[model samples]
Target: MPLQKTLLALEALDSAYVNGESVKQLFGAYPRVTVDVMTVQGEKGSTDFVKVVVPGSEGKRSGGQAPTMGIVGRLGGIGARPSRIGLVSDADGAVAAIAAALKLADMQTKGDTMKGDVIVTTHICPDAPTLPHEPVDFMDSPVDILQMNEHEVLPEMEAILSIDTTKGNRVINHKGIAISPTVKEGYILRVSEDLLRIMEMTTGQLPVTFPVTMQDITPYGNDLYHINSILQPAVATHAPVVGVAVTAQSAVPGCGTGASHEVDIASAVRFAVETAKEFTAGICSFYNESEYDRILGLYGSMRVLQTAGAQTTPAV
Candidate 1:
């Protein structure tokens, strides 16, 4: 069901010259869906940051009262290029995010519009560099984490689902998709039952979840060992962030070609789309307001964790 859109996005990204304009054209047919692309320059190179908005009938973009939900496709790059031949494993997050955006656009045309606007953000880079890591190599982005957060983590987003390829690690051995616990203001909260339920319905199997450590939620460039950049958005926003990881049983390098699986990526797409439906309708919540308030009152603000610690190097 979601494959049609997923494959469409894959075809769009599996190119040597893919850019913001090329991706923006995908939504030109839909009058309600608005797509925006900005080309940003970084140290290594540049990448196109793309945002697609699927407006809901009562969404705030139209001056309505409904909340806005954000879906960020977090990845370093779609391809390692010359060093790699084709679409690499890191590309799955972007594919799934774009596919979800396309599906939402199609749904709006067919009278399936949601109650609130859905904003999806992701960057496209055909050829990105690779960084050495412990278990495997990572798909290094053209921009640093700060640049990525600045473009992708919009303040308008009330809640965010960060989708990324989390395969280049020893943890999360499942071959399908996995979700991380709700992370907010440097606190790693319990897994959302609502999200788990949606995952079960979408995947038709038990919900799979990955672990998040204190260091994982902190900003990168601290010289700490993070699982990956899957939860990097958490460090940039006060909004509750959840990571939707495209995983594998083995430690697969992010730069490894021929490792992307369409079906598994589709599974993540389904989960995100369903969560958007429920989240906007007031039927699903990422974190409990009262519980979070209680924790905050008892422990004070944990927002310091959002910043680079004292005497740390400038954020790369």
Candidate 2:
């Protein structure tokens, strides 16, 4: 199962200097996947964006026109070093995403490749800064939000699954995983039945879902509250985006240590891997295209929500 991949990813990411080079070295055994590392520097420090592509048998790379599914491990940082030690709760997203990539790559090596390509993107930064929040602290990124979206959200991605560690909130009280509704352009559509079925089959429990407000769907730098950066990728692309949240029964600080449950992380990884397989095979759909077209024709566009609006004046 995904337990092996989960452990491998956790061990690899538990280091202080776990950069892209280390990831590249770890995935060297899988020759079917292509790993690329791009280092970007910000005001605080530098973080490496690690992108691993597991090519499908009849995917677009071979001119087969199969849609590509993107799995982005959305997180502030893997570790909040200099402030906190070891792996933080925010690292769950990175770990799960990496584990999914590893499992898919290994499957390819065993002649079980998917029908379309899977692009997995996440960053590696051990010593990231921590920001204060209402209930608890969050692991802030070394770079800004724009830089994060630019690197993680690729244009080739037809649909994106933005997985993040969402235990730092009190809204969702599940102890395993949760999914969000399909967010496209500026509309938050209904949750896909296909995804719900996959989640049930993987976890053998009722599916859990989290709420997304208008403010949450909007981009960062808007001076608004977001549960986390899980849906931030929606601001940069036209593709439908859904958030896969790793949750807890209680609100755990993102900077808290020893909060990541390996079993839950593995469950999320399994869900992602299965979704990647089904989505690319044309057996799953994120949203109804005809309904979306009708909505667009009737109500016009909500694209303005994707940007930061005009600066408001201070109240007298």
lDDT scores of the candidates, listed in order: 0.93, 0.92
For model 1, residues 116-140, the per-residue Cα lDDT tens digits are: 9999999999999999987999999
> Candidate 1, clashing residue pairs?
none
Q: Cα deviation in Å at residue 282, candidate 2?
A: 0.6
Clashes of each: 0, 0
lDDT of candidate 1? 0.93
Question: Pairing residues by index, what is the TM-score of model 2?
Answer: 0.98
CA RMSD, predictions in order = 2.4, 1.2
Error of 2 at 162 (Å): 0.4
Predict model 2's lDDT versus the native: 0.92
Candidate 2 residue 98 Cα shift, in angstroms, is 0.7
Residue 310: error of model 1 in Å?
Answer: 1.3
